[model samples]
Target: MEWYLKVLKNYFGFSGRARRKEYWMFVLISTVISIVLSLVDLGIGTFDEETGSGLLSTIYGLAVLIPTIAVSFRRLHDTNHSAWWLLIVLIPFLGALFLLIVFCFDSKEDNQYGPNPKAIPDDNAEIEA
Candidate 1:
């Protein structure tokens, strides 16, 4: 939940590096919310079976579009890749698979993007003995 909120707080931040935890957690929470919203839309008769999507989810998707792109850009940057690499999704199945693999790659030591997020301690984290 913290990771999700962190990403949202940086909603338009497309220039920094996003650690794997930040990227994946945001994806996980967003997916769960979309599913719940879809179910709610179905119960309210706002779901369109033909299109296989619901009004609430559609609206939610639109609301997250920019943030999604921004995060993807940052994630790619984290891996030392240009944000333009995100366009690889347009190449069909292989492209998406490639992107997924790229996302999974461990963060490279301070590259063109910025310092490694993993090396930076969280500002709100508590110190331990």
Candidate 2:
């Protein structure tokens, strides 16, 4: 999907705002890939205790982790909040809950962060001939 690729292209970019569609699509695709990679690694005996995770698995996680954090931060930016809010996840319980609420909630309209991502486009000029 274009949304998924858009996020990947901006992989390390922590600026700008990301809509719910973009963020959720990336998560969905990443999760499916991780599942498939883990299964393949298991088949090839890459699940050995020595390395813990196979090369593919490690790569898969890193690939997803980078985008996940980046998008999450961007999502926070959409709420007019600093990316540092991500550090809340480091706290035991309360912090995690707070961050979850922030990420799951919709963005406020026209805040300092940016315009509401879900706002409908104006079609007033389109004459209904």
lDDT of 2 at 90: 86
Tell me each candidate's TM-score: 0.93, 0.79
Total clashes in model 2, counting residue pairs 3 or more apart in sequence or in different chains: 0
lDDT of 1 by residue, 1-129 (tens): 888888888889989899887899899999999999999999999999999999999999999888888889999999999999999999989999999999999985999889999899896466221
List the candidate 2 regions with Cα displacement exceeding 4 Å.
50-52, 120-129
- What lDDT is obtained when candidate 2 is compared to the true structure? 0.78
Off by over 4 Å in 1: 127-129
Residue 121 CA displacement from its true place in model 2, Å: 6.5
Give residue 108's error in model 1 in angstroms: 3.8
Looking at candidate 1, the ten consecutive residues that score lowest on lDDT are: 120-129
